[model samples]
Target: MKIILDMMGGDNAPLSNLEGAAQAVKEYGVEIIGLGDEAACRKAAAEKNISLDGIQLVNCTENIEMCDEPARAVRTKKDSSIVVGLNMLKEGKGDAFVSAGSTGALHVGASLIVRTLRGVKRPALATIIPAKNKAYMLLDSGANVECRPEMLAAFAVMGSCYMARVEGRKNPTVALANNGAEESKGTPVLREAHQLLKTTPGINFVGNIEPRDVPNGDVDVVVCDGFTGNVILKLTEGVAKMILGMLKEMFMANVGSKLAYLLLRSGVADLKKKMDSEEYGGAPFLGARQPVIKAHGSSKAKAIKNAIRQAKICVDNDLCGTMQAALDELAAQSAGE
Candidate 1:
C-alpha cells in the first residue's frame, strides 16, 4: 500500500519523517510518498544516511506552520505540504495520509478534501490509551468539541468497529465516559447517548464508565464528546509523566534507594513503555472517507514508523468500509423507529 507522509509538518520535520519513512520502507516494505521540499528531504536523508529507494518525493512549495490559523492556512496554502498531501489522498493517489502537523488543519483539510463517510455526521479522532490489562480505544479525542446524542452514538459505533477490525478485539465492550457509572448520570446529552447505545445492535454496550475506571481497562471502547475525551487524554498523560518523575527522584535519593531501583529497573522500564503514547503511533480520524492518521507534533522516527504501521492496518482491514456498513445499519434502524 502507498502511504503519503507530511515531511514538513512536525517539530522534527523532514529529518524524523525521512528517517521514519526509510524504516517503514525497509521493514514494512511499503511505498512512501513524501510531501515537502524535495531538495531538503533529499539532503536530510543523505545526512542521516537514510535510504530513500522506496520513497517518492512530491515537492511542495509552502508549509503550514503550527501557529497559522487552521482553516485559513488550509484554504490559502494550496501548495503547502498539508494541503497537497491531503489532496493526494482525496484524489486516491495514496491509500492513507499520516501527519504530525496541526490537528486543526488536518481535521479541516480532511473534512473538506477527503470528506466523511456516508451517514457519518462528523469525523471523530480515536486514540489508543494504555490501560491495566491492555490498551483501549478512546473516541472523539479532540475533533468535535460539541456533539449531540446521535453524534456520540456514531462515535461508539466507529470506535467499536475499529477496535474489532484493527485491534483484533472481538465484540469489544463499549462504554460512555461519564461522571458516574450509573445510567442516569451525566448531562442530558450523555444520558440520551447512553440510552441510544444501550439499544444499538452489534456493539457490546457495557453501561457508563467513570473516568477513574478507564485506567483499569475494564472496557474496550470509551466514547465521549471531543471536549471530554481530550481532557481525559491530556490528564492521563500528565499524571503518568508526573508519577514517573517522582519515581526517578525517589530512586536516586540515596545509595539504598539506588540499589532498590536497580532491582526494579526492568519492571520500571516496562511501566514506562506501557505509558508512552508514542508506542501507539498516532490517533486516527475515524469516519473519514479514507484513512488519515494524526501523529504527535513532537513525534520521533519510531513514532512516525508506528503511525505508518497503524495506517497500513486501517487500509488492510477496510476500516472505513466497516464503519460505513455499521453506520448504515444504524441509519436504517433509526428510520424504522
Candidate 2:
C-alpha cells in the first residue's frame, strides 16, 4: 500500500519525516509518497545518512504555516504539501495520508478535498487516550467546538466502528462525557445525545460517564463535543507529565532515594511508556472518505514512524468504509423514527 506523507509538516521536518519514512518502509514493507520540496528533502536525508529507498517523492513548492488561516490556506495554497497530499488521497493515488502539519489546514483540506461520508454531518478528530488498563478512543478532540445532539450520536457510532475495526475491540462500550453519571446531567445537548445514543444502532451505549471515570478505563469510547474533548485531551496530557516529573524529582532527592529508584527503575520505565502520546502516533480524522491522520506538530522520527503504522492499520481495516456503513445505518434508523 502507498502512504502519502507530508515530509515538511512537523517541527523536525524533512529529516525526522525522512528517517521515519525509511523506518516505516523497512518495517511495514509499504511504499511511501513523500510530499514537500524535493531538493530540501534530498539534502536533509543525505546529511542525516538516511536512505529514501522504497519511497517516492512529490515536489510541493508551498507549505501551509501554523499561523496561516486554515480555510484560506487550504484553498489558495494549491502547491502546499498539505493540500497536494490530500488531493493525492482524494484521487486514490494512495491508500491513506499522514501529516504533522497545521491541524486547522489539514482538517480543512481533508474535508474539502476528500469529503466526509455521505450522511456524516461532520467528521471528528479521534485520538486514543491511555487509561488505567485500556486505551479508549476520544472523538471531536479538537475539531468542531460546538456540536448538535445528532452529531454526538454520530460520533458514538463512528468511534465504535473505529475501535472495533482498527483497535480490534469488539462491541466496544461507548459513553457520553458528562458532569455526572446521572441521565439528567450535562447541558441540554448532551442530555439529548444520551437519549439518542441509547437507541443508536451499531454501538453499545453505556449511559453517561463522568470525566473522573474516564481514566479508570470504564469505557471503550468517550463521546463529547470538540470543546469538551479537547479540554480532556490536554488536561490528561498535562497531568501525566506532572506526575512523571514529580517521580523523577523524588527519585533524585538523595543517595537513599537514588538507590530506591534503581530498584523501581524498570517499573517506572513501563509507566512512562504507557503514558507516552508517541505510542499512538496520531489522531485520525474519522468520517473522511479516506484515512487522514494528524500527527503531533512537534513529532520526531519515532512519532512519525508510528503515525505511518497507524495510517496503514486504518487502511488495512477499511476504516472509512466501516464508518460509512455505520453512518448509513444510523441515517436509516433516524428516517424510520
Candidate 1, residues 5-64, lDDT tens digits: the string is 999978999999999888999989999999999999999888888899899999999999
- In candidate 2, the residue pairs with backbone N, CA or C atoms under 3 Å apart (3 or more residues apart, or in different chains) clash, namely none
Predict model 1's lDDT versus the native: 0.92
Write one digit per residue (lDDT tens) for candidate 2, span 239-305. Answer: 8889889989999999999999999989988998888888899999988899999998888899999
Q: What is the C-alpha RMSD of each candidate to the true structure, in Å?
A: 1.0, 1.0
* C-alpha positional error of residue 271 in candidate 2 after TM-score superposition, expressed in Å: 0.5
Error of 1 at 184 (Å): 1.5
The ten-residue window of minimal lDDT in model 2 covers 115-124
